[model samples]
Target: MPEPIRTFRHFRDVPDSAWRWGNFSPAEIACRGTGQLKLHPEALDKLQALRDRLGKPLIVRSAYRSPEHNRAVGGAKASKHMDGTAFDIAMANHDPAAFEATARAVGFLGFGYYPRSGFMHIDLGPARTWGERFPVRAVPFALEVPAARETLAESRTMKGAGAAGVATVGAAGVEVAQGVLAEAQGAVLPLIPYLDSLRWIFIALALAGIAVAIWARVDDWRRGMQ
Candidate 1:
């Protein structure tokens, strides 16, 4: 048999209106677990503080979801909610964006503001966090490449003019050119200082060989005379 799933009660005990404004179904209720929705003790304390500071009845849309429940609800492949350390929340005033900003400032992890759903999701693991709605629209690729390249280039020419013309470029080209220049300079730098030394060494060796040959020739001539 599979390992038993985990759950919480504080989130489960919440009234139906809190989750979906009276639209919650039995399936949604049974989705996470069968208990008064509970959370990690530290998470509960911070949540209570958030409620107190916000001065409103904080609605917990989801405290914890069982693996089966998480799968049914179209949760992310790796959801913190399944571990009883994450929750989706909303307040009586229902300002999702505002709530999300405030929650993030309070050091909550994984704050997602859902304007359409009228709630903000919060997590309590790492103080590091993120915000924004899910399924964000993809950015244009053209804008991405040049933006990335600008920081890497030593210097670059901007082609095109006025508001009507635009040109594209990348960092790889500039980086390659810079690297070639660097290598060429490196190869030539060491040779410049050693040129005089090499010339002197060659001339001295030539003189030494010439002197040895002349001495041998003189000795041979004397022997011949005797």
Candidate 2:
């Protein structure tokens, strides 16, 4: 049996579970100009797989198109959008080369590069590629670091400051201990000089930590600017 076209007057009419594919809603693949929608299951399945492999959101520029909508947008007479097989995905959240590779791996065969528009078209049709490829980027898209990791790196400036606080507390603790030992006994007098020395060591460490904390804070600020 031929695969049936899933039609919706509006995406809102689609029951949530009716969309078997996860990570995508009927609205996302609906016709842009009209509320109407029609799509093939294979296309949505492949698209969901692509999204899963990428582990990120896809910025879909265009997907399904009604015949009227297709003509208004000056789409090809036989554009894949009408058949619900083509997708125009923006590269804002994706690296073009990587996106194409992943799209192909998920069974998309057609490629239409629109460098100036910053979007690419992919379809489950005859294997072919068209349009000018994007200029090789000096830097690929930055990997998304987990929020926890980013927060830890962003808080790096605090480490030195925290060390300084600890050292200051240590120095104060040494002085208090030195004073108590001074009043203990004559036999403990020999330990007095060492206690004083310990106090001085703590003070030196405290100063060093403070200096490091200052430098780290400055560096963190610079990074934020960049």
Give the number of the best model, judged by lDDT.
2
Could you give candidate 2's per-residue lDDT for residues 37-130 as a string of tens digits? 8868889889999999999998889999999999999999999999999999999888888898999999999999999999999999889999
How far out, in Å, is residue 157 in model 1? 82
Residue 127, candidate 2: alpha-carbon lDDT: 94
List TM-scores for all candidates, in order: 0.41, 0.71
TM-score of 2: 0.71
Distance (Å) between predicted and true CA of 164, model 2?
7.1
Which stretches of model 2 miss by more than 4 angstroms?
A: 1-3, 146-226
TM-score of 1: 0.41
User: Which tens-of-lDDT digit does each residue in 102-143 have in candidate 1?
Assistant: 676665877666656766678865654454464432532122
Point out where model 1 deviates above 4 Å: 1-33, 36-38, 125-226
Clashing pairs in 2: none
